[model samples]
Target: MNAQIAPPPAAAGWQAVIGLEIHAQLSTASKLFSGAPTAYGAEPNTQASLVDIALPGTLPVPNRAAIRKAIQFGLAIGAPIAPHSVFARKNYFYPDLPKGYQISQYELPVVGPGKLKVRVDDGRTIEVEIQRAHLEEDAGKSVHDAFHAETGIDLNRAGTPLLEIVSAPVMHSAAEAVAYMRTVHTLVRWLGICDGNMQEGSFRCDCNVSVRRSGTEQLGTRTEIKNVNSFRFVEKAIEYEIERQIRALENGEAIVQETRLYDPTRHQTRSMRSKESADDYRYFPDPDLPPLAIGAAEIERERSALPELPQARRERYIAVLGLPEADADQLCSDRATADYFEAVLAGVPGQAKLCANWVLGEVAAALNENAVEIAAAPVDAAALAQLLSRLREGVISGKIAKDVFAAMWAGEGSADVIIEARGLKQISDTGALATAIDAVLAEYAGQVADYRKGNDKLLQFFVGQVMKRTRGQANPQQLNELLKQKLAG
Candidate 1:
């Protein structure tokens, strides 16, 4: 899809123009401009180095890994990778900002002009235009109420690296905005540049929401919703903001441009502070670091290392594996589930549909019931494949296979072992099956006579009787054929 800015659907004659700025923390070992470690959950100031603390005469040196990741992300999104990008100092004052100013990109960012395809729940696909993705250093976190009458500072994240992705205000609805954000989230994680953990503050979004009258070209004043960590919250915050703006307009009140916070509990947005423009930040090139230079060779290396993205993988599953759209979507929802699905396919090649059914059906239910992920599944792919093999070979009926699967999930040995111990194998031996069928025919003589007299539906009755007489051990297909011949005679 071409990179075009399209507005979302209008609500009550007002169009919502939504844009998102997402900060994806780079999965790096050290800080962006210092050698300080970048591990989370570390005690306050323990991981901070002298440079991170901004000691006198401390110089800022760029981390190579973080920059490379930014380039990789740009390549993944088909963005232009700038040969020269400047690191600008954004001046701002906050308790968490130990450096008094943030080191970020402004005029010349590393990545420029990319687009992502967002597929909403209603099957409408829209291309969200990405303005730029710039590399920046994160600030420290403020611990509220850590000490009575005093807050605490944790500099462990002070110098962490981030790639701030800015998008154009084109989405017209909250759902479209969320679809765009989730597509970006999946892209970053699939590229292996970020963990994409919303709970860990690894990936967060800042939403810019505005509303205008239908068929109006002029844009409306936009409010910035800051630090929304989850996709559901992103949708909710935008929906509430749209409603708030419409009410203000209807009541003859002006929509103010400011920053707001989303209260997930109350499902509303509250004003945090007035929005700051670029000029407010006093952005200027940093004197401590020179402009970053990237050669064609470096960009090529990053591009060559890129894996197949999620969208492409989903298509491959549908086309190559012959999986249904819903099944492909569910398997490709996350990397863990996709990897597990492939592992099962590896064990049972040429049975993609069966593998998909089991993975999506019984396996998923078991995992949810046990409160675990696929990685911790009690019955691994190998064990499940073994059970499927038995079912295929007619060693067990479908009903007995479910019993064996249950036993396997409970930590019983392999499927074959469980089948042997329980004697639950299907009765496929013609001699034994014939004897069982004969007894069923003798017991249901009336039904048998009716079947020969053209009551063909009675075939089902005889099959059921035969299966019950054998305690569900008879191979259903074999029982059907034998019963048909006996009833005809």
Candidate 2:
């Protein structure tokens, strides 16, 4: 339902209504129709096929794997999987489309009606409802460069499978639209369904923006803004468009419903052309391919195989591990890293809190500095588990553990091996700690007397002296207790 956009009781109030359409290229082996390799970076024209070239009599055959992938995505978003779907001709004139009309899903789309919960790493989740997700073949791109007078067509990307996810007009601001887009990107990539590389055009989005009164129910005439390449661009485009619409209304000018292109350098949206309705294309069924049908059994099978979604895993981490909300969110952002963290915690006797602290801090830092993915980390869960076990047992001080981790990353050894090689064992021996404690007491008799007089601050000084004498190898837990006991006298 579209909200009314009349001027509010006040003259200056405005609300931004945004909806997003994201085009995500499906990850598959071959092109949708052409048998030519659907691979990236194959010297120009090497992967082109007869169908790609639009040679007469070359028929299009539906790729079963691509269809299955489309269905998988639909189920992932809880969308309605159409039992029977058809391909339609989206007729247009462009150098990239050799047939002058691109085959796409218009009337009977493969999927419909889904929603995604956008968590912007903020405390709130913005739930953007989905309008539909249609499976379509991507058109090849045309290149017009300053170096060449003639334009060139690259059909290497022709027939690439794409799922266009359209959202309901549930977003109220540019920031909300961006958050929804980011969440969708994260979900698809984490599921290994889409690479989500926007720079290479693996994923892209277009957002529809309009302004309305804060309390009015009527919708304003909306403008469709396209060519939003990055998150920052999406925000800037919406901001400019909203202001433009609001100004037009205030000036007694009608809001024009047109397609606009966002210029990042100028931070503005310029009119590209008037928007076209469905009839403009005259869409019809493709004679080459038969009607597509998805069965109930197949849907059931795919649903059962679906991985644990991000929100579920995040909640589980917070609930089961008692970790802070922010910490849990960070750890669960990556699927494999979350899995590895759970594995290391399984059946461990220590506090899970400490494990999370180490993982989020030192472990994550090392991985980032080395330019490595978590799955490719040199230290695995088993190794980390072994390492944390030592810290819990007071076998090494916290300072020594940092040295041990450095050594482990440098190919030194496991936790035990490094502890031995560096002679970094914790000095937890009560007798040794007591002798050192006695020396500190003698050196600072006044502080000891003050401690006996109920001063707790002097206790830290003793702990520091113990650590200094032991070269940071003193077990802090044991030293703490011993120092407290000695200071009591």
Task: Provide TM-scores for the models.
Answer: 0.91, 0.91
**Per-residue accuracy of model 1 over 1-489 as CA lDDT, tens digit each:** 233444445788988888999999999999998988988887779998988878788989999999999999999889999999999999988888878899999999999999887787777778789999999999888888768898898888888999999999978889988888888888888788999999999999999999889989999998899999999999999999999999999899998889999999998999987765633988999998899999999999998988877888888999999999889888887777787788888877888888889888889998999899888888888888888878888889888888889899998889989998988889999999999999888887887777888998888888888888888999999998887777767
Global CA lDDT computed for model 1? 0.89
Candidate 2 global TM-score: 0.91
Give RMSD to native, each candidate. 2.9, 3.7
Which residue ranges in model 2 land beyond 4 Å of their true spot? 1-11, 120-122, 276-279, 347-350, 443-455
Q: What is the lDDT of candidate 2?
A: 0.81
Looking at model 1, residue 14 earns an lDDT score of 88
Q: Each candidate: how many clashes?
A: 1, 7
User: Model 1 misses residue 264 by how many Å?
Assistant: 1.4
Which runs of model 1 end up more than 4 angstroms from their true locations? Answer: 1-8, 276-279, 446-465, 468-471
Candidate 1 clashes between residue pairs 3 or more apart in a chain or in different chains: 8-172
Q: What is candidate 1's CA lDDT for residue 431?
A: 97
Cα deviation in Å at residue 336, candidate 1? 2.8
